[model samples]
Target chain A: MSAYEKYLRNNRLPHILCSGCGHGIIMGAITRAIEKADLDQDRTVVVSGIGCSSRLPGYMDFDTLHTTHGRALGFATGVKFAKPELNVIVIMGDGDALAIGGNHFIHACRRNINITTIILNNNVYGMTSGQFSPMTPQGHFATTAPYGNVDRNFDICELSRAAGATYVARGSAYHAVMLTDLITKAIFNPGFSVVEAISQCPTYYGRKNKQGTAVDMLNAQKENCVTVAASAKITSDQMQGKIIIGELHKSEAPEYTAVYRNIVDSLQAKEMK
Target chain B: MSPTIKLLQGNEACVEGALAAGIQFYGGYPITPSTEIAELLAEKMPRVGSAFIQMEDEIAAMAAVIGASLTGAKSMTATSGPGFSLKQENLGYAIYTEIPCVIVNVMRGGPSTGLPTSPSQSDVMQARWGTHGDHPVIALCPSSVEETFWLTIRAFNLAEKYRTAVILLLDEVVGHMRERIEIPDHVDNVLTRKKPSVGREGYRPYQPDADLIPPMASFGEGYRYHVTGLTHDETGFPTNDTEKAGILIDRLHKKIDNNLDDIVEIETQMMEDAEIMVVAYGSTARSASRAVKDARALGIKAGLFRPITIWPFPANELKQYLPQLKQVIVAEMNLGQLILEVERNVAGKAPVHGVLRGDGELITPTQILARIKEVQ
Candidate 1:
């Protein structure tokens, strides 16, 4: 048996993801990361909002919460604040995190709470059959954007950094091993950490854009993505249209739950006096 | 030990009740008539070693409360009309997920932001149907500061006992009105959610006991389980089976409906030997109580039936009194809301008249008495 098998609910096999879907790769990476981090299974919780990616938690062997669309971060904040000892991780899709849940995403970052958020950016809403999302690139083809998307996409790593997340990183399904390493590092971060996992929705996103099968989409990621270290050495012209797939930001901040504990301690001490 | 007495606002009383009920987490936003609840809890929660968060929005606040509750904490959130509207989606999620938490809606007038500080019971219907889907609801209305204190605790107890979201529907008047209240030193019967007794291997998260409530396992208690808003089976995993969906919804309703005897509470005064009944609740009930006494003094056969548990409508209890009542007057601050329930329960056994004011004002005893005289 594989080391990650113990982390899965084997009874829930034959997941609902379509053939060539990259969400499976991301989910596998998360399980490996949790194992590598050596997090206590009983003390870990996986929360998700409504989406194809959000369904990942239901297959995992841990305390899992499948909440309303775009509200996973808010629920996760409550879980972490109420029980600071538990490790809380949130998974969301592009539309779940950026569109309907944008306000909560930014606020969760600004609070710098100790929780790991993984956003699976498949570019389009696969569950809703290729609806254009905030993370969809300009000129992308989606069911909602048959004439081609006119709205520009957001740089998720940059947005996370701007929103005050203490740790921000980006990885793709093509870089499975490195994605696991990044997720492990994010789990160790004491403040808010966001890892954007660029995933592929082959059934919807690939077909709509004629991006070929899942393998072709993954190969494209491998060809276009540049590591931050490598990008620094390349010319600006060479970096155009290239996705940076590495740790984009790291900083120290006072974690919210730890800061809140101080207030509670002092108040209890005063009452004792 | 003697209980402490103090002059407290209704919102402050709610805070006191929550503390007495051993509430460990509070998530809320700032909105008028209900803002005091958030303010006082913010100051008191940390002092008591509890967690309190002012979330980014009302929906987040409700989400936070449900999240906290899943970890076996007594969690609550407070909001007014607009915030309550924003919270409906998550509220529906809580209902479907069967997470135990308390939601305090201190209502003001509104189809949309009609009044912020004024008193209105306009949310009586919204509290039941605000969230989409056919679901059971437990809501309590408090008429005074003391009732607010006790009812807040009762709301938490019911939420935990039944494993459902309990709504404490307070109007702006009862939420903001100042009155003398005697707070008990300790709440004697604060209930917590039942925990699973079976081993982890055999435990099913959605398996109900004879009481129709499933024992809840805390997130870190080693009974690793799944919870979702989707239709789920006994194992707590989502299912697409039609029969399982029907059973899930049926159990959710039956858990509260089958146990209404313990969940419902009503106060009746001068009810015996009366031909006219006045049905009221919340701050409006205070006026109805006075009007009933005035009518009796005028030799009119009048009485009051105040439903403290507004949801589930106390229909069975109200129906029993219909035969004795020649006329029923449903007085409220709204144009009409709960009156519909009263009329339905009355079912033409007696004529039902509404004494309602939706103009950001309280329904006065004189107005209610005048209506009673006209009906007589």
Candidate 2:
């Protein structure tokens, strides 16, 4: 009944996301962002790898591809390179993007292809039932890490920026409107763009970490995150343990498809001459 | 137009054949014997306005080919032993999803990175059962540069026709060997994936026709359908229903099995009234071809049954010659791979022998001739 509802496959409704899961909220943000960006529903593709968050594309009303685990970027890169005219949006989970798929993730950023990648960082592998992931906070409890996780978590926004993403941003599921704006901007970018959407896994991640209910987790995001603009004014001591939310990086670069196209055009021009 | 004739390596001929077959996209990694496929496509794809991408790894390369194929592009990728092993993951995905793409595995000696520059047909078994699961496969083996050219085109055609991944298995000797080949002015009967005639409304992405092949709609075609690796239904959405999964898996096998007559191709040399038959494929077949002629010249009735389509196994065709065969010799670079398949099909009708070498050397015609003489 809502305007963005048209972007969903109503027939596939009653999504498999657990009660109070933040993936639904993030999914709404994605649909809203696609609508806001005015992407032709027919010309846009939603690709995902295997995971709980990766299942989101199956419910979208667009050309959707649910590929192998950790290979969404690889598949999306092919789609973008094959048909640069089509808008390619890739959805992935923290484990799907950073753990098994880490090589593809970095290479996709390095290629600077025109793809919008939204990584739903829920801190643990919810689909596989709370296994420790690369995004799991250090010393956190997971099913696999019974005593406590010793692995250091990646700063996703920093990693994306370092990997040559032309546009990098981070938003929480609590900030649904801000997440939509960030995703929309990522869609508009002419090169590779990454938006890390911190989502809550109430059933697995929250319960395993003793983080109370999903509502409590959302409230924690509200209290722990500082806007990049606001963080600039805050002292290092004041910003401790606070995640930064907002656009973290932006720059111009020659997109992979455009560079390839130039090579093709010049070769054809030589043939003409 | 006159056909251009030039000496070309088997890998180079594969590139020419792919271009002639209307390949619009290529995603590959650099690997021995197969690297030339990526190298030449890089130079030619730009000129032809098609897409060429060197992926980070073989897995990504295979994934990209499937993605590009979903856009209705005739896409392909090439790799060798280790790379082919890495590609198995995505190859299985493509098989389950029914994406039309060509995977060229120019095999080298390997259990694990054994020999990078050496020829080995060790991957023949891997080509059939590498990906895991009871899935259908269509694989072609070429014995020379000329056969490589035509088989590469045929691989793409079969991929499109069945809406499944086709493997072009070439060994290092055949892939690297150079020979003069005629470049035809035009390639006839290049098949593309069938597009749905029905409109976007009431469209089921996996609804098969009478031939059991579902017409594909490219990503941007407004059909807005879903594709997944999980066992899916006619609507293309993942289904957990046991019956639906059975139907899906069964149909995938039947589509290729029922069309085996149209798919399987076997080349026979002096098979008529021959009491001894040599079963070979890929570069090994070249040696077997020469050995058969040598046997005939020595007043012995020896023949060769070279399976061009190695995967659907060509059992029916091989069975036809079983009534007269006293013994069967399978010669290959591997110690023993396809020989198992030969024994299975021959089913004790004839004594089967293997002239196999795994030490990075081709099985010589003399070796095959000796085996034929001993069996005779």
Candidate 3:
């Protein structure tokens, strides 16, 4: 048996998801990361919000929390606090993370929670069938945006950096190798870390937004992407709205759990009499 | 002597109460009135290898508390007003999942961050129906700081004993008050959590053998079980079967409602021959208790009936108090929240008078006294 099978739920098979859907690919990447990290299968927790991406944990063999819309971060906060040593990972789509859960996402970054957030950014709401999202590109067409989206889109990588994510990166499902490496770095980071994977959504988002074939979308990502470090050194004219890929930000800060553990000493000293 | 008596604030007593309850984990963000609890627990919980983690927000704080409790630790979180508003969803999750945890709301002001450092009990209605579902909840309100510690311990005990979400309701006044409280040792406190009888082999996650309270098979203990907020089956899988759904709903209430006798908590002062009684809870009860004593001294028959268990609302016991009562004045910081329940219970036999203040400050004994005189 593959290392990934141990983390998969046995009862349910043949999930009701479309073919070539990137959720399965991302789940595969996550399980592989867990295997590579040698994380204890039991102690690892997977939490997700309401979306096609949210069902990933339910299909997993480990302890999972399938929570309300955009509330996965809140629930994961609980999981981490309950057992700081536990490896907690939150998996949700762009709509779930960058929109309804936008407040929590930014705050989680600021709090510097020791968890991994893998955002499957397809730029369109797949579960609810293509509603414009915070990450949806400008002029992107959706059911809700008939005349094309007029609102300026948010760059998730830039947002994560601004929100104080200790480790921030963007990888494309188009480049599976780079995506895996970025996800691994995020999982290994000690503080709030986010890896936004540009995933494919051929079923709804692709067919509607004119991204055409899944392969075409993959090529588009590859052509439009630039390394974060490369773009940082260059001016806006050289960038010209290119998707900055690779590790965007990486730094260290005192994590919440460690700082919290210090309170015991303070209280003990106070009561020494 | 037992202990030197002191006139402490209700909020201060709550801090002391949680100290006595043997709190090990406190994860809460600071909000009005309730901030004192996080303040006190942050100081006290760390003494005995315990911890107080100030989470990102109330949502994270409550989540952390719920998470900590699963590790077989006594955990709690404190909040009030808007912070309390943020905790409702997780509170419901705790209820449906039957996670043993304690939450304290030092209620002050408003439907929406109305008042912070002041007093309002509007959360009374929210505490019962705030979370968006039909599930049982065990809430306790303390009238004084003394009861604060006692009830705080009871909050943990009842949470463990019943395996349900327990609320410790304190007004700003009660939560911040400091009284000389004599807290008994660990051996003397009431603590509970059922151990698995099958020795982990025949352990079903939601299967309750006899008492309807299932043993907590903690995480990482080799006893794997799934827990969710959706309508789930005995095996903890999301299911839509009507019979299974019915059973799940029935057990949620049965765990607490059927055991209401054990869960029901109250404080009654001088009800023997009182013509007019005051019904209240939380810090307001302290004000009412004093009014009852003073009213009796002035030759007005007065008694105080306070509900310690606010959710399963002491329905039967409260119904008995309805008859032969000329008037029952329900004084609360919120604009007539708990009074609505009193009115429903008393039905019109004894005019249920409501004295309310929603501007985010507590109703004092003096204010309640004036209201009682006017009603008389």
Using DockQ as the measure, the top candidate is 2
Deviation in angstroms for A186 in model 1?
0.3
> Compared with the true structure, what per-residue lDDT tens digits does model 2 show for residues A1-273?
887999999999999989998999999999999999999999999999999999999999999999999999999999999999999999999999999999999999999999999999999999888899999988999999998899999998889989999999999999999999999999999999999999998898899888899999999999999999999998999998999999999999999999999999999999999
Query: Which residue ranges in model 3 land beyond 4 Å of their true spot?
Result: A213-245, A262-273, B1-9, B185-187, B195-202, B294-300, B359-376
Q: Each prediction's TM-score against the native?
A: 0.99, 0.99, 0.89
> For model 1, how does the per-residue alpha-carbon lDDT over B1-376 read when each residue is reduced to its tens digit?
8899999999999999999999999999899989999999999999989999999999999999999998989999999999999999999988888899999999998879888989999999899999999999999999999999999999999999898999999999999889999998877999999999988998999999998889999998988899999889999999999999999899999988898899999999999887999999999999999999999999999999999999988999888887788999999988889999999889999999999889899999999999989999
- The DockQ-based CAPRI class assigned to model 3 is acceptable
User: Lowest summed-lDDT stretch of 10 residues in model 3 chain A?
Assistant: A259-268
Descending-lDDT candidate ranking: 2, 1, 3
Expressed as tens digits, the lDDT of each residue in B1-376 for candidate 3 is: 2554556666656666666666667788978776666776666666777766776678767776776676666778888878878999888888888888888888777777676767667788888888997878788887666777678778889998888889887777767666666544442656868867675458777888688887887665656566777888777767879999999889888878788888897778998777788998877787899998888878888889889888888878777765657888998876678888888888888888887887766678888787778777
The TM-score of chain B in candidate 2 is 0.99
Docking class of 1: high
Chain A of model 1 scored by TM-score: 0.99
* Model 3 lDDT on a 0 to 1 scale: 0.79
Model 3 lDDT at residue B261? 87
Q: Report model 1's TM-score to 2 decimal places.
A: 0.99
